[model samples]
Target: MATFNKFFSSVFLAVLYASSYGNAAPWPTNAKHGTHRVRTLGKGVQVEAFHPPSSYKTYGAGVDLASSFTSSGIEDKTVSYISSELQVDSAKVTFKSGYTQNGQSFAYAKQVHNGIPVSNAVANVAFKDNKVIAFGHSFVDTSKIAPSTPSVDVNAVIPKTEEVLEGKKNEIEPTLEYHALADGSVALAHVFQVQNDEAGTWYKAFVDAHTGDLISVTDYVADASYKVLPVNKELITDGLELVTDPQNTASSPSGWHSDGKSNTTDTSGNNVVAYKGSVSSTTKQSADNLVFDYTYDTTKAPDVANNVNAARTNAFYLVNSYHDTLYQYGFTEASFNFQNDNFGKGGAGNDRIRISVQDASGTDNADFATPPDGQSGQCRMFIWTATNPKRDGVLENDIPLHEVTHGLTNRMTGGGTGECLQSLEAGGMGEGWSDIVADWFSHSDSADVTDFIMGQYVTNDPAGIRSHPYSTSASTNPLRYSDIAKLDEVHNIGEVRTVHPEMVLFKSLTFFFLPNPL
Candidate 1:
């Protein structure tokens, strides 16, 4: 919602993404200094975000707080709502600023304990229909008493902090603030933001009020950057070119190459370990400069498999790109997404996707094998023999995009058992989800749903593999649910089930495209 305010900004959104997103920590300094942030993304309209403080519980759409408290306006009402939720007085909740859009209202407020402000504690609220529709809270405990006056003064701790920070060229005077501890306890801390000459090292260090120990430190350095292939309408159509780093910080806080355990200077990263082979054989693209610039040679024989290195690079790029894209849509670790080192967010860990490009296993089609959450999902992209020179399914962006969605739908359903798609109907729906994923990814425009085709580039067929392109018109796509009774094949049944959902999806989201940020 570019033009709208924070809460229920534009349209089709009001979706909540809160809790369990890890924050950056000290490297040999493992301290829990995580600050939760919740954001809601509507289509292309506007936005809202929710990240509750490190509390025991978080509430969403269903947990209505309308009957709790009342105020003259949304501003005071938001403050009162948070106060009631936290069992604190309304005076402790102080409103900073907010705005209203399309009749929905939102307000941002900070938590205060006995008048001294609490660090990293805030409430972002949305109001509608005379009730608190939804809100994001990251508040500290006011019930537990902290020191009103600091035993360790701000001035006395600078030299000690300076020793830790090496040499501080510029510094913000330390302020006394209440810091929340991992044990659900509160400690009065002196907060300092200092900058140094060492490669522009800046630190937000917290010192304990009683003993003056370093509570937590966040290095305000730049995130890692990379140049890789991005999602275009179709990579085969647009050709290859490395775009600047497209990492989503909310999902990948440590960057793509690092999974908090170790770092990779190549295609192997936290989300995926990509290579070219029948199995785990090595053909990884190593770029110390973080640029994966493998070129596809169309003039060569067996067009796709001849340049095996480029196939691996292309597959690697698609997996990571689609991983971040799905994360924004709530395929989170808590929701059973594939990722190595889930950063203690939730679900299984060390299950990063393993992709094999130009696989010697088979040809003419690609596939993904998804086990449970903790196990790595295997994606095998085969060469297509439809034309004189075969096409690699890896280079066809939608093909890999389709396969990755198979992992998503398989792991997400039936409590992430990965065996839920055993039934013919269930298996058909799984295939349907894959086609829909690619269809949406390749949707030419907002109104480009009726003519969407999957595997067009790989198959070298204008009509694609399925019986029909996903279309609303009965003439273009005549498949109905009753046809599932006649069809025993999963992909065939999938063609039947896909058309109707695409109609529904096209209706819901007025605009659809993944590459651009929402």
Candidate 2:
């Protein structure tokens, strides 16, 4: 219930935020009075309002909200305030100019009216939950002021020298376009192609046009090739839809496996059983590629509640651990819910899907609630039974990040193995990178290194090992990239030991080595 409340509350706040600017009152001054109130908020700005108090004639004056009090008409109010300059336009007598936010001066016009600047300027500035209120000589209300950022007109010509970003070979060309939403945030959209044996799909990224920062990306799979079947709508929703692979000509179908087949039981008195399924590929993409399509299942009462809480806790850790310098980022949108039939089937035999879930009171021969090696417990991913309705969402589970990292690394950098010794020999750095990200998400680092492994939080028979270090070894050379050597000389301890004494001079020089960002 607490989870439900929090989820709803967040949704409500977001809706309210998207709704009207609730109590944002306008400049709070009459246009006819040249004498108006001036207010200040903190040190960022001051606002002064002016209305032509006595001008019933052709002359009039108005207040300038932006730093640049650039006037628009031909009447003069002849008002002056501390540290402010006014420029007069002869043709438009009411037209006058003042300072711009950029520190350059600009011109504006006002109607003929009273001669003194307004006073008693109370201002209100909204921040996160707190309103900054102040009084100042010049009242500059910028709350409703919008900036005119640089933008290319839609029909503008593309410069021959203007380079466009591209994807790799066999990839669909990106669709780049500038957008001005009817509601007004300028955005840029870029499309990329994604291919599966069944069919090809497209993904899009949205960026802030003015800032060039990625705001979001939407995944799109062609409905003809893939079907989006939803099983749960109450609490969770899956963005990716599941559909049968057109390339698959298989005739046989196995019932989705359930946890009841195994000894696994839910001790929390929740609907304990789970579901699992997979699609077989005609040919393996790679040894490191996702062995099979994904599976999902619903959590029982307490499981639902527990998982939601866990999601928030972990999300907080991830958000704080990185991007601390910037006040907010994508993680602020953390949410928890179940998903079903997320990915479509693949093109032959049994599909291998990874399953994980938290065990309650160790009834299912699962690991202790806490890690054995004093490592912190990580969120786990359990296999979903096909019959089950609720399955974990990527945001709700950390496993997706870890497992997806492995898949991405394998795809991006040629397939690599995760075997301890061999990975140390050739793929150790990659392996460490995975672990670093996994641990880093939990805000764990070398300074706070613990014995937790990638899947330690899974409620599996034996909890995954947590004693793993980023590198298989350690080194005395402070400047060397911490690799397998930092943990131990296991790769070739004897040879390394023997060569160390004879090559002390070379080894000492290693101290000056600095690693390049990979």
Candidate 3:
């Protein structure tokens, strides 16, 4: 996070002085007007008889205060106060808005000079108990600012905007606005809004009206990706495993997971599809997606209501965590994440992940499908029933992580456009990467890498779901590049290259040394 050191120098000195006086000192009070109590702290900066109780104080340049204050007629009161303190004309300060709370209010005003608004010049006055308390200002010196008019017309800048946006320009007239420059000066600029529906891009461009040069641009769309109440039922992650009940199953409260704001119906946020009915085709059907509204029932055994609810909640949490973590590492809107809420900034909407729980078509398999760009990716987690008992694919953490990693690898590796790792050799590499990631999450501790098994809970088999548990020993997996022809399947071939001792060493080195390298 960035700190405003340039704006808080006086406040820091005041804090040090207050610390010397000890805690019992009375709160700092502002001095009387037209007195020597006001002292110059820095160039164009002044401080009055300030004795704040806390270590923090608000101070700024071009800030002045009035002799008296009142809550009623706030605009007139604030304008008069600023005019007297800064020794500027009262007509120059214009009231913007009043931010109010219980017995407190903050009047925000902007400075307009010679019919042109001064960019970044603001005056804020704090009031408590209907009396003046504190204030801060960052006003430009009006005498130093020279008046100017725009030279180029708005129509002349349209072509330049289209060229920069590479998309259709929004059909709106460009507005003339004063923009602040890097040197603390303001200029007349025309702001243009441009968007491209095909590419899911939107931004605002500021063009210098005098020279037709692009001053700056701000992108609007941001990545915001969500919900449920009723009797909350969810799967709680107990270390590496997920358990239905965090406490006693019969008496404990509902443990359903939530992002704290969204509801049970998945259509609103992040749009997870956890359905119970069967589907005729492998593709996701919007109508068949389950809506989580079940009341809590502890006595009920692994039924659809509790099991599917847990699946939906766990899937939403896991996918969102991975998405946000990857975003910090640069997998952002340009990289194509599955989300609908673009945060009013830049993102291709309608790309939410479609997750299907207990897909009826198969009982022992789970998979993720990465469609073309701008389309929703589909993830199907099937039930495991090959053994004497049945197991849900969602209950286990490794299964979902392994499946979702496929989508991440697909979108990130190909520049958000084409398929990645399509050849036989590449397919093996893809599977190996997914397994390695899942293992990282499932491992008991950072140093413990002896166990590299996948889906141990879902499958009772000693080897788990794979042909052989992953190991860093040549005896367990001795296949070399020349042995690629010996195996035809992708998973089998992946084991040959994945379990090599050299690959394990490389993964360990990167995981421990790199900062968010994944």
> Could you give candidate 2's per-residue lDDT for residues 1-518 as a string of tens digits?
33323332332222111111112212123221123223221222333322111111100122333333224211122222112332322221222222111111122222121221111111111112111111111122323222333243322212110112121212334444333232323344332322221112222333333444433322221110112122111112223233333221121111121111332111110111121112110111111321222222234432454443332222222212221211121111111011111122211111122222332212211110111111111222332322243233323223444433332222112101111111112222223333333433443222442323333323231233233222223342222322224333222221222122221222122111112211
- TM-scores for all predictions: 0.55, 0.22, 0.44
Tens-digit lDDT track of model 3 for 121-187: 5555655555555554545554434345778987898786667666556765576766555454566
Full-model lDDT for every candidate:
0.60, 0.23, 0.49
Cα error, candidate 2, residue 149 (Å): 33
Backbone N/Cα/C clashes per model: 11, 67, 15
| lDDT by residue (tens digit), candidate 1, 307-423 | 676776667667888888767655777657888888877678888988877766677877776665777777777778887677777777777887888787666543343533433
- Model 3 spans with C-alpha error above 4 angstroms: 1-268, 271-273, 278-304, 344-347, 506-518
* Total colliding residue pairs, candidate 2: 67
Off by over 4 Å in 1: 1-229, 278-287, 302-306, 448-450, 501-504, 510-518
Deviation (Å) of 8 in candidate 2: 37
Most TM-score-accurate candidate: 1
lDDT, residue 219, candidate 2: 23
In terms of lDDT, which candidate is strongest?
Answer: 1
